[model samples]
Target: MKKIVSKKDIAHLDQRFRANFINSIEGFKALNLVGTIHSNGGTNLAPFNSIFHIGANPPLIGMVSRPDTVDRHTLENIRSTGQFTLNHVNETIYRKAHQSAARYDTNVSEFKAVGLNEQFINGFSAPFVQESKLKMGLELREIKTVELNGTYIIIGEIIHIEMATNKISEDGFVDIQQLGTITVAGLDAYYKTSLLERLPYAKPLM
Candidate 1:
């Protein structure tokens, strides 16, 4: 027997669903993206999850920050210095990454609170996490304000990248399972990654 999914039925399903669909969709993929930014006066700040690399042509990366109902440290720091760093979260320092997300006053430094080492590179004013398995410093390129939303999307041009020896592939592919990367779920939970088969790109008839 054949069945068709009516538009009314689809809409009903959304209302009927008990669990938060978004939470399940996003976290199940599993990879927490951590970021570190330096303040104007040489303060090192660390925050975790919800960052992704967009392009390599001009070396671009994107970050989404929730708007400041309280104090916007990350957004304020980036706005002030126009620079930030992205640190990929791994198993060795998962606890530190989690700590970075804690609520703190504008004067408090997340980096110092978590006991992570901050590294400064020449030619870039932003500080990066020295203890991170992989980290990169970027110069702010663009900032787009979302419509009717409290958050902001930030874009940066990658100026420098540091990585551990064993994790990087010969072709430069970052293997999550090899690095033991930790991922986030429901805005707070963390988990390790597992290996799945690599598949080829899909093609359609011409």
Candidate 2:
């Protein structure tokens, strides 16, 4: 049986309860480690669950940055450098990836603090999580503010991709389940994935 929690109830709930409850209501979210480098050459790695593909034509991906009310190092660096990386969190590094969220001083590199390796290929400004099995290099396309909530939507165009060759299927679909990409619930819970049957494109009977 489902418990009914109305808007009124939600509004009256404890603050921390509301945070966890609201975030968890969405079921599962895609978790990735966003890597960036500050203008002073300080590197950062933070995990986020808000990444979504904006389009494939230009290979764009979008992610959300919470209100700038607090010090958001990732957002600041992306703006200054116009580059960042979206690296999928896998089973091996999920704990380290989660730990990267702890508020650290500006001079600290979460990549180093959390024991994850930082990788950079020529021409890409942002670092990549070398521990990640699947990673994408992105160039900033736009940053739009949400007038209602004060959050931000960052859109980026995928410029480069690196992954293990065997993870890709012959038809070109990247096998995420095989890659051990983890899905997150609420703030800290992580779950591994398994492949279900793939169905053909839906078509209506005439």
| Every model: Cα RMSD to truth | 4.9, 1.4
TM-score of each: 0.77, 0.95
Full-model lDDT, candidate 1:
0.68
lDDT per residue as tens, model 1, 103-161: 86666677777887767888777667777767778888998888776678889898887
C-alpha local distance difference test of each model: 0.68, 0.89
Give candidate 2's TM-score. Answer: 0.95
Error of 2 at 66 (Å): 0.9
lDDT of 2 by residue, 59-154 (tens): 998999985522288999999999999999999999999899998888889999999999999999899999898999999999999989888999
